[model samples]
Target chain A: MQKSRDYAEWYSRYIDDELSAEEKQAFLKYLDENPQEKAIVQRLQSLQQNLAQLPPTDTSEGFETVLRTRIQIEKKIGYGAIHTFFQRWRMPFLGFATALVVFLVFSGLKGIRWDGMPTDETAVNHASMQNSLSLPASNINYTLDQFIASPSYSTDAASIHYQPAEDETMNKNQGVVVDSTGKIKQETTKTIPENLQLSY
Target chain B: MEGREEQSKGKKPSDEELIARFQQGDIYAFDLIVKRYKQQLLNFVFRFLNNRELAEDVVQETFLRVYRKRHAYKQVAKFSTWIYTIAGNLSRTELRRRKRRKLFSLSDIGMEEKDYEIASDEFNPEKYTNTVMHEKIIQREINKLSSKFREVILLRDVQGLAYEEIAEIVNVPLGTVKSRVNRARLRLQEQLKKSL
Candidate 1:
């Protein structure tokens, strides 16, 4: 019975002439042993041929004229230009858009950690990390690499100690002396301002 | 001869070439495309919807889409497959709309009824009855087929499209198309056996 069913598939192939010449011979030999199967193949062939011959209907009248008119209207309004563009590109666009939305949703969820009051341990960790890091608004998205490399980063608990410098000491004891006493410099002692001059 | 030159020029531009021309905005090429596939699409849609009027509407819409979306067509597939896909989709949509209205245009209304009415009036009425009844039986069996089987059979047998093309048109794997076609042919025979 299983064998007969396998041969049944060949019936369509035989009818469609898809079988190789050798398979055609094999199918014929098999059919000769099976009259009922042979009859069925003959009938299927008849049916298919009848269907093939079934009159192909032509466009009623002025199908082109009507379609042309509709096309002219379509051109005028140019509707479905966007619709057709979307229709043609529907799948790829949908796929990209879906990926984008999903990514944004997930990323947005991840980004929202700093926005709301911390409710969960992860959010709390993020909040503490943000405050402890004192991340500047400009560098809000400071990454791990940046964190490690930042000047504020220290193994010891060293907080920032910013201090203003004095302007007086910032200026140099302006000139170079060859020795403590023998100052055959560029004869610039007269040119030196009192505060900037080196004391002999 | 000028006619020969026109024929050579005509060398029958392939459907691809015609559409290529149409894509280049040759209105004449567009006219040729409409003329070429119009009837074939009509018959396919007509069989699919089993409604002459609606089938024409669907075919018209199919062409309108081809015209509007001419630039969207790529050479990756045959133009016939592309157009048939359009017609087939419209036909299926119309089929769903038809089901909503609970209207099946089988023998209760169809081409067979109108075919004999026109042919018999012009020719022998007696002969027309027998032939028409036979065709009516076949058509009814065709209508009895599930939409899945019906579409495949129509594409494979009636329209004489390649299995690959049918597969593309129906968006099924080639193996599935082969089996569906085989089973559909058998089912059609089994049904026609009883009635015919």
Candidate 2:
């Protein structure tokens, strides 16, 4: 049964002329010895031939037209709608891009701010800090002069004002120290208890 | 309507080129793709279900999916393989729906289209020489196989795809495709002998 089953598989390949030369010779020899199975091979070949000759099934006469119409409906209903959307908007996008580049070039040549627009940074001091600071969580780092221009003093004259935490309390678990001004103060471990592992 | 299926030079763009163009928003590329594949896919799906209308619908759905998911196709795989996979999946799903529908479908209450079968002439054993009758019997036998055997058999014997290509289309190991196809052929041969 197993030998015949192998021969049956080989018959399929044989019909297709797929068996290698040596295998083909062997398959033919086996078929000669087994006349009954040769009929089976003839049957498979006839079926294949009939299927092959089974008139190339032409689709319905309007097949292409129908498909095209369906695709057109799809085009309107968001099939490739993204592609269509970009196509419809392409010229506008190019126009917008050009306008942006022109605006950028003009702005670059002039001061970054058009004369009426105030581009100057806002000045914040202790008063602003008290209003906005979450002291324990804040860590702002900027000099007042960096933001506000000093009329009498040079901008270099100002130093970074390190804001201390309100009431100088440090949140130990968070290991963060802040001030009423949102600027962060550097924390120093001023007192280290003598531990065996450490050198003074 | 201006479908460019083949180049004037008789050297058409590769499937990859067409799909790439489709991806780049060239609707005509999709037209070419449709013209190229519709008949073959219809034949495949039609043979799968043994129903012309449903097969055409499945092929359309397959193309629609291809249109929607053009970006999903990568250059790494053959476009035919990718599209065939879609058609095959849709065909299988339709087959299952048909089987389930057969059980409960009543002509009066069917929300779906009424079952229109290929009217195979009453099994006349002596009429085996009639080619039309033979074709009908063969198609019926194909549809009656389990979906796996039916699928591999169609791809191999009817479509004549290489075992390697069939493997990739069906997403199976090459040996599995060969095994299933051989089994299908053996069964088909037996049934056809009896029928004819």
Candidate 3:
């Protein structure tokens, strides 16, 4: 009793108004020619109507009131949870936070030593540079004099000889010079430990 | 005052506009959004879930989420899709919960596999009278459908959402959504014809 193939597809689209105007006209013409197919369209329409007419279920009265109260309660519970969190862990959190802040500030104010505190050589170099920059030239000279006057100052400049490395040897003559310097370095090594001890 | 004038002039703002206002912390706008969606969501959820109480609970939870997550709504998305997605997810969760409960109850009672399908407290035939028998039949057929099919039909035909919106709410490809809706409708049509 119903049309077949493309007409059937058109029937579905026709009901939904999804068919093109030309398709709709052709479909209507097919329906007019086959009156029995009208029942099919009617059936589909009735189904759509029935579905739309299916009893709408509304929330009971005071729905908003109940919902509002519930939202309020939920908000309160949420607020309470956060409040309790702060209340319960206030001191510990404060302590941890304070400790973290203090650590950060201290680390910021004091220089960051990549390998912990500076070694004696670096500290001495830093102190000397700071004194040289900050003090008057006369004061720096006086400080240098006091530093040299110390018993820790090693005055033997020849003992601090630079030995030409093996690769740096000019010739066999250079080897003789390096041999003598090596002896001088060996002799000064014993006295250098005493100077380091006094300097520390 | 301008909004009031527009309301008096018979032009209503769109859902997106209302949601945008709500996002700006307008309490009245929030109330309007809730009022607008309450009944529609109730109907959608009631059909999805066959119980009034459960449907109402889900709607309540849906609204609760809307209130709680108002800021999560992006202006790029339709408010309807966002709210429907929330309701659909809640409905799916309730269905899953019911399924687990049914399984546990069936095991507890040592029931056979056949009775397991009919073991829900919701299947009271007494409530489906002669007057509403057709509606009851339709509801029963819908309930008999798989969740995916049922949800697609409900969203498409019952709620009259566009296929694109349904796809967005269900989080499926557009082609998949269209096919599911067509298949669901065909299946429902067959059942409806037989019942008639």
- Per TM-score, the best of the predicted structures is 1
lDDT of 2 at B8: 57
- The segments of candidate 1 whose C-alpha lies over 4 angstroms from its true place after superposition are A1-3, A81-200, B1-10, B103-133
Task: Please estimate how well model 2 matches the true structure, expressed as its whole-model Cα lDDT.
Answer: 0.70
| Local error of candidate 2 at residue A86 (angstroms) | 23
Give the lowest summed-lDDT range of ten residues in model 2 chain A: A191-200
Best by DockQ, which number? 1
- Give model 1's TM-score versus the native structure: 0.62
Report the C-alpha lDDT of model 1 over A74-119, residue by residue, as the tens digit: 7788787767787899899899999999987776676545465323
List A-chain TM-scores for all predictions: 0.40, 0.37, 0.34
Error of 3 at B24 (Å): 1.9
Model 2 steric clash pairs: A164-A179, A165-A178, A165-A179
Interface RMSD of each: 3.3, 2.9, 4.5
TM-score each candidate.
Answer: 0.62, 0.61, 0.58
Q: DockQ for each of the predicted structures, in order? A: 0.38, 0.26, 0.23
Candidate 2 CAPRI category? acceptable
Candidate lDDT values, in order: 0.72, 0.70, 0.70
Please give the C-alpha DockQ score of model 3: 0.23
Instruction: Please identify which of the two predictions, 1 or 3, would achieve the higher lDDT against the true structure.
Output: 1
- Tens-digit lDDT string for candidate 2 (A5-68): 6777787689878899999988988888888888778767777776665544567888768877
